[model samples]
Target chain A: MIETDQLTRCYGHLTAVDALSIRVEPGQVLGLLGPNGAGKSTAMRMIAGFLIPTSGTARVCGYDVAREPLKAKRALGYLPEGAPSYGEMTVREFLQFIVRMRGLKADAAYRRFDEVVQRLQLEDVLGLCIDTLSKGLRRRVGLAQAILHDPPVLMLDEPTDGLDPNQKHAVRQLIDTMARERTILISTHLLEEVHALCNRVVIIARGKLLADATPAELEQRSRYHGAVSFSAPGSGMSQEMLGRLPQVASIEVDPLDGRITVFPKVGERILEPVERLLREQGLEVSEIQLERGRLDEVFRQITTQETDGARDAVAGVNA
Target chain B: MSPIAAVMRRELRSYFVTPVAYVFLVIFLVLAGTLTFYAGDFYEREQADLQPFFVMHPWLYLILVPAITMRMWAEEAKGGTLELLLTLPLTLWQAMLGKFLAAWLFIGLALGLTFPIWITVDYLGAPDNGVIAAGYLGSWLMAGTFIAIGACLSALTRSQVVAFILTALVCVLLILAGQPQVLDFFQGALPRKLVHAIAHLSMLQHFDAISRGVLDVRDLLYFLISMIGWLIAGVLLLDLKRTR
Candidate 1:
């Protein structure tokens, strides 16, 4: 329900968000991943109808953000970075204000207020002023305000930034539940959040889209995909010996954890053969599992490559 | 509710919840009382009119109105709530007018609380209630003019202190443009029509004409037009920042 066509934003000589286009369909959760200054938030701001795009168009539910802002804004709910809120207002008051600003009727506003409060578990701090609440509580309040209206399109920037582990999980669950019928585009630096909450991931760096795919698809890009990792009690299997096993391309032994991770050659299955080898050697395996590769590894690979390429271009100019 | 009313309610609620409204009311009332009795010499003049009280309004508003409006948009920008506010389905005019009306009503409340002074004048002598009524109306319009200027200035910066200082300086210059002391310097050097135009632009001059029970449509239009002009300018600035 969200689409941007060659959307660009420039501040003086710096292009904060370059010519970019992205589409988020209904019932799909998109994880927008990028490092600092990747223009993720800027792109979100433009789509939310807050910042005007320097060129091109951002449309929500078929309404142009620049032309029919009110209609486009009506379809979207945005949680900006830092979850900034009016500190003087109580949590309840703030949510109520948001409900009204969203143009809900009194009965509908109150009903939605109760629903979001219950969903976010904000009952405890309902009457407390926002400034006096803890960071996590404040973030929840901010979240409650954004989703109170239950807009069709939700753009959340770091929705779980300051929350504790439990709170983060709860918010992820909330987003998951909401994702059943709406379009959600969340930008976060936490790679695990993409795996946990997003079905589709869009990776951007230096104001350009580098990769966009499913979490599983991105994970498959890692060399560690289909690797087998097992921990044994002081097993005498050296890295070289483990590497000699059929289909085992490489092996690594963690000195601290005593885990042996064996990477298979492309298009090979090493788990069955490795298990057979361990059985033949009479070594006790404490734990063993197959991994789909680490998302963090792929994230690092994509973002760093962009930076390195930029550096090489700079060097080429200098030469 | 309409978007304007919705925003107005929120802004008004925030005003009272913080210390800004109370502090502004106390300071404004204290200064009004002080200026009326000490500086304007109300008791020494022994006049049955509220001329002394009416005369000090433009000056009082020049300083205090900025205090009331300095944080209107500055705090929104600083705290990042401007994003939340602007991204809503409301138009820019709705939000700007909502905030401006909230501040104007707050100043009106502060002005309304000075009823005891009117009562005192009534108890002491047979004063012209019509003139006093006109003074209140004129004072309210002048206060709104200052508030609109302050709102425009507040939108230009993210610093409340800067908003207050710049608004006060602008108000001072506008008032001084018509002051006898300042106008005398230009009287002999400038053309007559140009001097008259400059003096006519002063908000203080329009307020004086109205407070004297003249009730001129031109003076009322001036205040209304200036208020709308400044608020429009504030909205334009916000629009500029949005694109940037």
Candidate 2:
């Protein structure tokens, strides 16, 4: 439903988005992840037809954003970074204005309006001016406007930024439900949100695409992938002895709890081997488990490595 | 509804929802009343014509029109709603025209409310109603010209104060171009034809021709072309900003 062909946007000496390309299929929720100044918003703006890409092209539902802006915009709804709206307008007034601008028929517009108002729970504040609403409420109002016309594609930048926990959950739920019928591209810094909501994740840094894959696939790149952990009562097996095992690459002992974590060599099956070793070594094992890697750990590794590389590049220039 | 109409409706509703519409109405009516009766000396002249009233419109609008239009695009840029509006399915020209018509209609409403002055003139003596009607048309055209320039300036920055001051300054120059002192500045330094060209560009000169019931096509074309020129410049400026 959305595609970009080497989308590039440069501001003088700094490139905001650099030769970035992406494709989002229908019914896919794509979580765009990056650190500060990572070109996430710039890419989304180009897709939404608000900003012209310095080179290449962005297309939504088969229409080029620059060539056929109106058509591309018709197929997409965008919630910008701050969720700006007409402060003087009431929530209902603002939504209705959008509906009219979208060119919906009267009956269809009002019905859709009522549906979004109820869905976003904006009934009580319908008559209040937008500026008078709290941050969470204002975010919900922004959500309501984006979903009001029920466009087939959605580009949301920080949709859950200011919401309280419950409101954030509500918005995530709404996005989850809407993903069944639309293509969603959401940019956020929250790793957990990406895990919980996105089927596909794309990580970028310094205007370059760094990683793109499923959440599980990205997690597999972590150092802790397929590691094993067990808490035992004073296992007499020394760290050196365990390190001798062919499958066991490293082991960590928690001093206070006397628990041991075993990391396997790449492509090695250590769970069975470690269990057999512990059984033969006279260790009283209370708990043992195999684990998938943590997404947060992998996220930090990937993003920080990129930052360090950027710093090194700057340092190299100085040298 | 068309794109322009939709935008105009929203813009008009926004005007009333804030204090801008009410405050503007009050100030405009008071100024018009005071200027006509006190400064223009309408009753002392003892003529049924509304010459005193119509003559003050350009100067009144020099300040007031910019006040109304300074926020037209500047507020959108500041509040970040310009992104939302542009990303909608409307063309740039459609949005600009919509906003322009909305402000133009608002100025028309303010001009319309001064009907009591027209009634007062009718009651006192036999005034030439044709000339009065022509004067109103002329005033509305001049309002459009001022709004177009203000709209262009508003697109240059996000600060409404800056937009207001700059628009007022430009309109002052445009209105003062025909004054004797201004023409005198060029009298010896430039040729007679060049001075005439400068005077012809003055909004006051064209408006005076129209208000006196001489509805020349040249004056009409002058207002229309200038209005379109400024609006096109405003739209281009907005597009330039979006590229960044």
| Candidate achieving the largest TM-score | 1
Interface quality of candidate 2 as DockQ: 0.82
Q: Write the per-residue lDDT of candidate 2 for residues B1-244, one digit (tens) a residue.
A: 8889999999999889889999999999999999999999999999999999999999899989999999999999999899889999999899999999999999999999999999999999999999999999999999999999999999999999999999999999999999999999999999999999999999999999999999999999999999999999999999999887
Q: What is candidate 1's CA lDDT for residue A107?
A: 88
- How far residue A130's Cα lies from its native spot in candidate 1, in Å, is 0.7
lDDT of 1 by residue, A139-217 (tens): 9998888898898999999999999999999999999999988999999999889989999999998889999899999
Show pairs that collide, candidate 2.
none
User: Residue A63: error of model 1 in Å?
Assistant: 0.8
- Runs off by more than 4 Å, candidate 1: A233-238, B187-190
Which digits, one per residue and each the tens of the lDDT, describe model 2 over residues A140-252?
A: 99888888889999989999998998998999999999999799999999987997799999999888888999999987887778888888775655556778999888898
Predicted chain B of candidate 1, TM-score versus the true chain B: 0.97
Among these predicted structures, which one has the highest lDDT?
A: 2
